[model samples]
Target: MSTAPLSAPRPSPPMPRRTGRLFALTGAVVGVIYGYDTGSISGALVFLSKDFDLTETEKGLVNSILVFGSILGALIGGKLADALGRRAAMLIVACSYAVFVALSAVAPNVEVLDAVRFLLGVAIGISIVAAPLYVAESTPARIRGASVAAYQVATVVGIVLTYFVNWGLSGGGHWRWMLGLSAIPAALVVIPLLRLPDTPRWYVLKGRTERAVEVMAATDPDADPHAEVAAVRAALTEESGGSVRSLLRKPYARAAVFVVGLGFFCQITGINAVTYYSPQIFEEMGFTGNGQNFLLPSFVELASLVAAVLAILIIDRLGRRVVLLTGIGTMAVMLAVLTVVFSAGKLHGATTWVGFAAILLFTAAFNFGFGSLIWVYASEAFPAQLRSTGASVMLTADLVANLVIAQFFPSLMAKAGAAATFAGLGVLALCALAFAAVTAPETKGRQLEEIQDYWSNGGRWPTAPEPGPVGAGPLGGSAASPASPS
Candidate 1:
């Protein structure tokens, strides 16, 4: 009895490497939204304060309340990502961003603006968790650093783009447009994502093996789909659960210490302080004439983008620990020099130039190492099951530190003066350096599954795969359609 003649074998559809590219590109829109949100305010505040007649404390609250909102979004979004899915969480974030940004634009008073900005922060926080996690999970291990670094590159682009936007809007009382324009891009990012699927890792965890295999085929065509499925299944089986509580155990707990420290220090070391207040800082350094205050930081963020590109080139080669240490060391030294320069209280001539140059150097150094690696490392430091939760926990520390720095920076500059304020930040850089030296492991060239084993094995490097076909790495060529799995 020919059982209806076993259906002729189905052919495996062509697996386009574009899947990986699309993954990074789509994830980066969130970064653009994030960058624009944070950077636009730096310029908008110039007008916002004037119109509202805001006090320094009021200014600080407006800048910092977004961070407070992000803290809540991160914690809740983490659970949502794990419980529902990454794709869903990101969709919610995008819609929220568009709606809240429009609301923020229309607010008539400082109190109303503050409330809307805080709600907007919730969207930023959720995107922070969703974007990096999606990039890390969706790409192959080999190109993971570059893929995540793309997010940083997009951030710098968004920041730089806002500089121009802020400039165009500067001549008019158009700060509202600067704040509201983000809705356009937020809506744009959503359109492409509608066609995208939840990550294969999430599918595997949910026991949707068929769907996982389909996604894996598209993303990493050379890898055996069944092997990929089995690996995720096995990894999940070895774990007790995928909750935040699970992350507080054994090897994961140790990794958490490192990640949390990285997150907290990443902010407290004054990166965001410099970014959010570059114009004010430049003005204080006597670069205010001729619109140089805004122009110079626009140039600096351009340099930051270049540094991010350099990081993508070198991170996998030099390794995370080496790059991070180098970055922290350079930033600390630059901050120290600025401390000395500001202490001299020189407002013009060579001294002013020296302080200005130091800010440029610090901005470049940060994006080169710590800025690029922080998210990449945080995303990789946890196991598959705990990645989203771990990233959330890490980012929560980051935002808390961000809130403290943003809220207190003006007051600190007032109370301690610029020299002492930067001096405190410079010292935090030393602390970050020490933490990396002690706890940060080299994560280059390892699979996500392999990284968990590496951490469990007392921080040993995982066995490296032998070099394979050209373009076989994560960012490689399209695959020829093969016979479907029998």
Candidate 2:
């Protein structure tokens, strides 16, 4: 009997390594959609509350349902993508979110809309984990830091765009328009995912040797796929059992702690708080000159993208710890200045703009360091088999923290005032600096499998592999793909 293609795998074609720009573009689109969906709510809620007769707490509740729902989605999305493949999984996530966002536009009242928004949050969470992990698993290590960073960059872009849309549409009281517009990007994702190949790492893990090869070929056009295929299969099959449970044992535990802790610390710095409430916070601080225009969010996005691009260029050379510590520490200083300015009751007009500039500078520094580095580190800290689960754990913590602050920021700004909030964030940034100084290890210039073994065994350097043939399969691919598994 003749075996079918799935049963009898074909040989992998010659697959060339793609340029960093392709990966960056792919990542940028995904990130921008993520940012837009999440940030659009900031403006959408204004009209939503009026249309639905939502109370202050009710409005917060509706807005926060998304974050709360995303927590579970982020955790599960990683495992789902790892098992089902990043390309397919992402398509599912995008479509699901598009439907949910569309549903949100037709809700009968605040109650139903809040529930739908929560569901949409779940979709957003799925995209967040899947997108970054996919980019990390697919990109080459040389540009992994930046490629994964495409998540942050895209996020800022999405935020900028969403705000622009909200600002434009707000005048017409077209709340539904803002909610409905997200479907465009969701639709945009469907096409790319169809074109995008599965993560090479996923194929190796599934023992789908031949498909893995073909997928890698599609990702890059010139390199021989056979050599890389053999290498990837060897790494997956040869590697030992590594999963979420294994990450907490012995040497790997340190890496886990650092990842989770830093992930926690990153959110605590009030980045999410600011992101979720940028416009509201500005208004509360008496920001008037910017005129609630798209210009503000667009500038923030520009600054963030520039920082992320710069970070992608220098991250490997500077080391993760150095970049994160430097950026967060600098952010703390800015936050301190912001605190003093706000506390002195000099927060309106020019002072507010100066505060906004301080915030933008902090955003740039963050993208240059922490924002860009988090996904890279998460993907790298885990091994071939455990990346998805590991990323899930870290991201769940991130999502939960995001929910907490997003739900509270407006109230915090109102009750505690800008001074206390900025002061509190400065403290969190300080904590992040100290944590990185102590626990983080360097992954600069290292190969993927080597880095895995090192993380699994306390940064023990792996014996360098000889430079093999271009089509040598995955001889050098593991953390090198546009998206790492984690």
Candidate 3:
């Protein structure tokens, strides 16, 4: 009896290394816009309060309105990314930044400044969703973690750059110049994006097979375009029934919960509370004066940049779970230290430096884990069809948590004291450590398609044998073609 021909396994296609790097660099530019805006506000608020005669409540509102706007942006960003395409969505974000950043520089009143900043937040919301997704989709699995981390690297660089700008201008209080410098970088992002194409997976999802193949060829010359395209199509077929709500159902729900929880906890752990109010926090610790306040926080941001670089170097090697657990644990310890220092009443001499050291170490730990990995996790955690939507949901949670911290942190500190406030954040850090240990998966070296398959296989990592060539039987199983692009 003649046996039917047996199917053979094919090796995974090589990633588009050069093209992936280019896309990653482009995402970094998007990150620069995000970082500059986030950091600029921290210093600008100092001069802004004086210029506007602001109260603590008003300061909180000014700081938080941008985060609130980001919430609105995150809500819409997913749909925009899906409907308009990631490249187009990011282009819109870049243009919006140029306009709003310029407007922020020229605002005649705090109301107008707040309104402009809110609009800028919308752009930020969309870029954060689209940029990392753009890089994650374009990059090869081997270096995908590092490539995505590049966005975080640029983000830290932007923050550090802004801090220096704030310091230079703090001498003269050139808050307008500080906010406006970002417009230059915003305009710069548009140039590279104009030349790039949407991700290959996105093209496949849209059923533009020819374009997808072209992108695959350009990005990964070593890749088998036909094989990769078929794999994507097979993966898309598996996700044909997916929607925003589907993320709350079986398989996908675990990922959604992990990602959303990550987003929420990353913020509530007090990274932004430090980023937004570090100068003020230091001032409260008795390091007063405009130049002196921004000067110390600049070092804090520098430490964060160094930690982000370290994450880029080791994220893939150590895996997401290891890095996250280490970082969160360190953060909890540092926060506990800060609680003790703050409880000693206003810091002086060695105690003051000790408080500074704790803050610096806390931020470094934060950047190493949560800041660097959050985007990588958000971008890679969902099926191709739901990638943007999932990222949006995570970002929305992040911004909402950030809003609470920004809006109520000062009041909380006043009412409960700095020690109590930090103790609360410390508690949250411990909770995050447990949550990450229990829920966060090791995604290093896995292809995005394999990750989706993990979810489809009921919470277990997919270990089924690789199938015959694409269209033979899904990559690992059978499913229908993806739904028509929305």
- By TM-score, the best candidate is 3
Q: Candidate 1 lDDT, tens digit per residue, 138-166? A: 88878898899889888888898888888
Clash count (model 3, backbone only): 1
lDDT of 2 by residue, 76-138 (tens): 887788778877778888788678878888888887887888788777777777777677766
Each candidate: how many clashes? 0, 31, 1
RMSD of each: 7.7, 5.4, 7.0
Which 10-residue window in model 2 sums to the lowest lDDT? 477-486
- Note the Cα lDDT for every prediction shown: 0.83, 0.72, 0.85
lDDT of 1 at 37: 89
Q: TM-score of each candidate?
A: 0.91, 0.87, 0.92
TM-score of 2: 0.87
For candidate 3, the per-residue lDDT at 66 reads 91
Which candidate achieves the best lDDT against the true structure?
3
Cα lDDT tens digits, model 3, 1-486, are: 322225532433344446767788888988977899998988888898899999887888888989989999998998888888889998999999999999999989999998998999898988889888888888778788998988998998888888889888988888899889989888888998887888998888877776777777767777788888888877787675546897897668888998999999989999988888878888888888656778888888889889999999999898887788889999999999999999898689998989899999999999899988899999889878888889999999999999989988888988999999999999999999998888887889987877775555554564445545544433345333332211
lDDT (C-alpha) at residue 135 in model 3: 89
Off by over 4 Å in 2: 1-6, 9-24, 217-231, 238-242, 293-295, 346-350, 460-486
